[model samples]
Target: MKRFLSGTVPRFTLTFFCLWLASLKLIAQENARKVIRNIEIERHDVFTDLNRKPRFIYSWANQLHIVTRENVIRQELLFKSGDEYDAEILEESERKLRSLSYFGEVTVVVKTEGEAFVDVLVTTQDQWSTIVAYVFEGGGGRTTFGGGIEEFNFLGLGKRIFSEITHEVSEGTQIQLRYTDPQLFSSRWTARGNFITGPFLKDYSVRIIRPFYALDTKWAYGFTGFARDQTRRFFANSREFDRFREEKEEFQVFGARAFGSRFHKRRVQLGYRFSTKDITAVPDRMVVPLPDDEVSHALILTATFENLSFVEETQIDKFVRVEDLALGNITQVSLGRTGIPFPNGVKRFELRVIRSEAHQIFDRQYLFLTLGVQTLFEKNTIASFRLRYYNKFARRQTLGINIEFDYADSLEDSQLLLGGDSGLRGYPARAFTGDKRLLLNVEDRIFSSVNILTVQLGGVLFFDAGNVWSEETSINLNDLNYSAGFGLRLGYVKSPDSRVGRIDFGWALNGGGFGIVVGVDQIFSVN
Candidate 1:
């Protein structure tokens, strides 16, 4: 035993031991398989039978198209008649089907057909994904109104098309169009295009992805081309810089592969970008120099591992709710390098790591945490962490708390500074910026269900406190800003529910003033 611990064992012995362990696991898996004698597909309506309930005739009238084809459902199945039953494969199939925006709920059940055979039943319920929407959104002393039409599952072929026109209060109007084909030309390749035009911004992009998901597939590939006018209003150490614009064109190509399991994946990407900047309107007080026209070429590599589990509960024709949410774990790591003998003469290396996890605790309570670390080779390192807690203290009530902290060592102007736009509800966009920041948010949510009309209404009261500071200044309690707000949540009833919209009104305690935010099911997440 001592010799083995000291690495005195022969290499062949170690290899044999590994092979033996793998064989044992394989044998166990083989023993678990039962013959699958039959496969069945069950597809439900896009909307619940709300007519059964009084005063829900509106739901019946709003019914759209049934966009998912039976063949589309069958193509995603991991098993077929005479195939062996594997629980992991079955769950994976369900997950893949649910990932489609058109699907509200996906369940795969296996039942014994005879002594040694089982039947596979795959059931799927559709979601109302065709949205012709009008938006009137305002927040943080700004207002934006827009209108859009989106078909998420066009003609049941899993295609998407969206077009919108918007007019901002102070900013000018904008028009946008987006289209996507998940299965291009009846193949596995996916294609996407986006276009946006406005007085201050013009952006267009096209992308294609050949994803690698099959057990026998070795690699995936993606390519993208984009041209955009990016505007940035920089604020550092609580001081603002005049708006800066960069007109840039970029092209990128990437390839990736899975290792050991589909949940673990890695990719390498190469890209070239050409940019010309104009900062003529930059304030004279700004200390940073404006960037000149230049070109850049770079390579980036990334790896990610994801494993999550969740359960979806549905009410017939009314709504689907995801309860017992558990994020097993997810981690991503990336490294990038720029200017390898490039024409633009740029040189930089960057690395980042992100990890997130969620689990239940003590029956009715849950905890979720996310951590991020980033570095620009040899110069600066930034780390961010967030911890969240959720408690279901009552049948229809929940309490949520989120705490976040961010720090930067030797910060640079080119780096992204922590700012209010992240989630300081009362503060205007970019109102605060600094090398370090801290935030705390607490929320109490109450849900009320209107089953007859297939509507779910929720109300939330929240408190937010946070501050950003520079390296030269220490964080002060007096410098912190506080915001108290109430928000309304509207969702449609169904198995696997959908958020219809949200409206928030907040009051600032530290002279930031009052703000109201309106959104259509848009939720913010810490990046």
Candidate 2:
């Protein structure tokens, strides 16, 4: 027995020692591959050089704009000195920086120093962060005019401050104040607050969150509260028929934990929500009954799956700007229940499922699809589907198509509307109201190489068709409305937001006459 024990112990000890040596060697190799030696950051102002025409004006503009702080850019990076060197991580860092509206250009370059060391260089160009201008939007004979001042990068930090005063046809004059800090207190947390007041409404909201800013983020949490008191107006054929006063308060808090790698991830979240709503009908103009008042307290659980894949393109949404499109799949499912007995002895339950998928159908064509379903058991249900397709068939040109459908069961006081403001550009706003809606939009977008005083230009020819039906009416293609239009686009290249302004003219085929639509940004989004 002693002889056998001695032989077995020696063999086992030698094997274990060899395995440990192998593990140590493997770890050393991994460290050699991942070690980063130094990082350099270069920040440029709105104008890197003043050698072009209007040099004096460009110089003055650059002097007026404050370049972003080095720390602000450094804080957003996912890797730093002594961290692992990963190409995907570097690309993700570039994307993160580019996503910020304040940065007009971002690039990350890496140089291998030795077998175990690499140097990274990050470069960024700033945009004009302060905007002071008049905002005007007119469509279907209705016009909303306003002016606002916004500073997207306040004091060289990634903060936003905005104040605006606007006059709308339905709600009269309104004043709004908003502030946001993407990196609150130089940390990952974000904070935002908004207050709006008008003759017919008062609203306020506050949100604080430490979100999953990266795919490998392990935990996240957030809190949001909102309150609003407003006069809700119902319109038909662009005419107000009924109005009510609604007061609502909502509060929600959630925490999530993520698991998996950067390429594929899963997140599980738990949340609690409390909300109350009350309605009062107008005394002399009560054409419709008021919605029922209710209070709810619920607990919710949600699971999410995200497959991370992206494609970078230019001239798709904004001219001369880089845009990243997610070409992966995302799915989420949520379940909620108000299981506790209330004063009214009523219980409620809710379920929501959302899925989105994107595909590269061809070399230059992409398609995106989204589906959503939500239900409050025994109360109401809503189902919506959207499809967006884009073909970059030629340089500086794209063909974009969008299709959307929505259906609601047991709709109460609310209405599903379609009109000039909602993709059916020929008719007035709220010209069609129903429980089901279908809309299709096609655009041949042509981005010009012309730049007039730093402003890029583009044009679009579009066709729109849509129909809406009440629950009592059956769906019919013959009842569809049609509109054709052409528009001009102006891309503000120097602005921090890179805003695109559009003006469109439409001719209605179904009795509605000519219409003009003016707005900011692209009319539709793929997501």
Candidate 3:
């Protein structure tokens, strides 16, 4: 009996549970449709459908098979029974459902129930989100491969469990594991933990966050504990590679208060952090001496404003797929101070800010801008801007133009660089370095309906130009490196908004070179 309970009983129990759910959905949908049809109601313009010959629409729902608890969906809904019908809210709820990545498609319908009331029905198609993905990339003077398995909605609770192993032929092998609970204990508190191990690197971190989404959740708080040990390679004075090793350990705690509703909230936060770093530098390829081992304890204060909106669909643009289009701006400002003692002794202060904005330019065109700035009170400052314009004309035809620029008064061993996998598609790995960098990219993405197995194929035509220069050097038009390429893309769209497996192949123009890469969305472009 014990053996049977352990084996056959569990399977039978799951089967029975699924059957029970299907039956419930069937009964509920039938009854709801009857209620909607029998209610005496005046005609509503919103509920009328001109596309259909009858003009009157009847609403129903189709529920897909899944283990997800119905309460999960109920909690995410922005409107409820007895509430006035709003098409915008219904569409917004559908977008949110799709964005969860658990559903392939979400459909919401509205029908008149009474003079001032409407009945709403939501239908969802579940996606196979338990992913076991493999990655293989090569050809750009480098080779890398890895695999990962993840469950984004573990136990139908919107939790995530992920594990991966990656190997770079020239570098080494790395293994990582991460777990996240967007909401714990059915509360707004979020928690995440991650660990990584490798021959030359190790990392571990645990964090908890209380977001300011609910009206009563004004006092948001977060805490994190982390440690890292890693070996890194860097170029000195625009020279060849040099090895550097670092060990970092830190802990932080923060709290915030929100001022408004979830849709339009501003926050003020304060935090304290303590950290220590140990460094080992190679003396041979040194352009400058490295900073000595040090410990830092600092207080940080920040203010952030958010006003973002989303649209379900747009007219004349067919490229609207699983995700909603974002429109609005988000900005944050932060100040930090590190000193011997809070009362008296002082060392240094830092300030940083960032902003991102998106807006519709024309019928099908959109513009996006992101800007960031960082400064150490007096010593140095760094600023960067990214501007993009794109048009989603159709499923197979899309155009985009992007400009990225960065400027820094100083250089650090572990700072941004211009070449390699990041831009400059045809440049060699880490081939350029300086205090200022600029890059421009233009691409025409063309997609195809060819699906081999679960993989969808696409292609792109691209052009890239970029340069990096130091304070002693001036920007020159002739100094810009040029590359043009054609690319192949492979995508596995098992989930609506989740990017499971993506690979890209790029070939440069003028016989410059060619490379292939794999990333979360498209390839990393490592030529």
Candidate 4:
């Protein structure tokens, strides 16, 4: 018995020792894997090289622009020294950098320093951040003119300050001021404030939020307050028939928690909101009955599902600029119930659903679809659907198609309209008003590989068809309005924002005459 026990004890000890050695080996292997040892930031000015045309202007622009601070760039990175190397995280970091309006380009690359160490290099090129410009838009014999000064990357700290003054034919003169800080106090919090005053309007809003900045973020919270007093006009056949005064105030606070893996995330949010809206008919103007006033103190619940994936593409929206296209699914459902009854002794229950899906159908073709529905239980409902498709059929050409449908049941003070100011582009603004609307647009886009003094050039030939149905009118397929036009696109490559200037001329097929439309950005956008 003593000999057997001695042999068993020795075998057990040997086995334990072997297992310990194996574990040590495994730990050593993990430690030997390549880790980020250093991070290098390379920042370029607005003009990296001044050898191109308009060198003098380019030099002056660069001199005027302040490059972003290194620490600011580092703060946006998802990784740092001593972290294990991950290509996906690096890609995400690049996307985050590019998302900033200050950067015209962003790239992240890793270099192996030794068997167990890596060096990460991050490169960014600044855009011309200070913009002093005039805004002009003329459509359907109506025009709006304005001028603004904006500092997108104020003091190179990634803050935005903007002030603008404008005059509109319908709204009189307006003055607007806005300030935004993406990283308030160098933390994850964001703050934004806007104030606008016009002869007919006074509006202001403030928001502070710590959003889900990353796919793996665990929690988020925010609060917002808004107040507006405005003159509302009701239009018929592009002419105002009635006017009213509206005053609204809103406040909301929310908190959210995220779950699931980085690739697919699910979030739930709880919130409370208080809002009041009042409308009164103008004394002298053609009087229309005021819409029902509303006051609500509500609790809100929301659930969202998102798939985190993106496709990096060029010339899709911005010419020659890198655009990260979200290519996946996102769905949200929200429910709200009011605890305090309205003055009419009625409680409110609301439901809202939104879904968007994007897919790459082919090597250079994509499709995007979105659906939204908002309903006040037993009172009213509004539903909207959109479809956008793009095909890069040639190396320098793309075909884009957009379709939109909006319908409402028991609409109150709002009206859906389609005309020159919308997408029709050939008739007077707000020529048609109704409870239901449908619009279709098709464009053949041609991109030029030409850069003239830093501006990129493109062109588009488009066709538009739309119709609206009032509640009293029956739907008719034969009543569709049609227009065809061509437009020029000027991409301000050096500008902080990626909006293109457009000028289009459209001829109405129904003998509504010709119109000219001038605006910024594409006429139809997926977002």
Which order, best to worst by TM-score? 2, 4, 1, 3
* lDDT on C-alpha atoms for all candidate structures: 0.70, 0.88, 0.67, 0.88
Give the higher-TM-score candidate: 1 or 3.
1
Q: Give one digit per residue, the lDDT tens place, for model 3 in 325-395.
A: 77888899999988633533335788999998988888777888989999975645889998887786785
TM-score of 4: 0.92
What clash count does candidate 4 reach? Answer: 0
Cα-based TM-score, every candidate: 0.81, 0.92, 0.78, 0.92
TM-score pick, better of 2 and 4: 2
Off by over 4 Å in 4: 1-34, 284-288, 340-346
* lDDT at 239, model 1: 53
N/CA/C clash count, model 2: 0
Residue 12, candidate 1: how far off, in angstroms? 47
**Total clashing residue pairs per candidate?**
11, 0, 0, 0
